[model samples]
Target: MFQVALTGLLTGLALIIAVGAQNAFLLRQGIRGEQVLPIVLTCLLSDVVAITAGVFGLGIVLERWPSVLPVAQVLGGVYLIAFGVHAAMRAWRPGTLDAGDGTAMTTGRAIMLTLALTWLNPHFYLDAVLMLGTVANSFGADRWWFLAGTLVASVLWFFGLGFGARLLRGIFARPTAWRVLDSGIAVVMGTLGVGLLAH
Candidate 1:
């Protein structure tokens, strides 16, 4: 059980610790100190649900229903491109990175965006559902322990990222830093969007 749990934890971290739309948005919110708790909770809950679904056999459903993937791919690609464009605009004219900069997002809007970022990405489904599910199933009877480990990993990661981002507040105090960050986000999102479309 310990070995299976460790494997799940490490695998979960490996899949999640990547530069992507979800991480970028979370980091931005954390740095701005805007609805950080809600955002983090939303991410954590979403991951738990996704991971649970995968471990319980959503991956098999996905495999049997081939059309679902292409539909998700198209939707995810379009949404990512639109988001990337918005990020690019922000990069071009970054405002103050402070919470009181008159650019703070409303909690409702922030939550909606968080949901979109979490759900609309096909990669999220691939990683959280298909890949993780397949891997967890490989452990046979101990798969539940593996799933629990993944849940732990997800909890740690979202909390760490959402809270730890405050440490970078000093650097992000400058508009230039925001510009650079947004620009990087734009590139990553755009590239992923295009990749999904190409597939």
Candidate 2:
């Protein structure tokens, strides 16, 4: 059980710890000191639901109905591209952290964007549902342990990222830093969006 859980943990981290849209958005929020707690919780709960669905059985349904992925791919791809454009705009003219040139990244909007990013992205579903599900199912009777391991990984990662990002607040005081971060986000989001579309 220990080894199996460890495997699950490592696997979850391998997939989760990357420069994805979700991570970038969360990092921005954390650094900006805006709705960090809710955003972190949103991420944590979303992962719980996704990984839980995968571990229990949703992967099988998705496998049998392979047609569902393409639809998700299109929708997700378009959304990602739009989001990337928004990031690019921000990069082009980054404002003061405290005053986003009157365009505040509010809590409600942030939460809604987080939901869209979480649900509309087919890549997320692929990783959490299909890939992780396939892996957890391999544990057979000990799949619960695997689930627990993955859950722990999600919890640790979201919490660490959301809170730990505050440590770099000092660097983001300059508008140039914001531009650089947003530029990176724009590139990543755009690339992923295009990949999804091409897929």
lDDT of 2: 0.86
Q: List pairs with backbone clashes in candidate 2.
A: none
The per-residue C-alpha lDDT of model 1 at residue 153 equals: 93
Per-prediction TM-score, please? 0.94, 0.94
| lDDT (10s digit) by residue, model 2, range 56-144 | 89999999999998998899889889989998998898663332331366778878888888888887889999899989999999988
lDDT of 1 by residue, 12-55 (tens): 99999999888988988888777888888899899999999999
Which parts of model 2 are misplaced by more than 4 Å? Answer: 96-103
lDDT of 1: 0.87
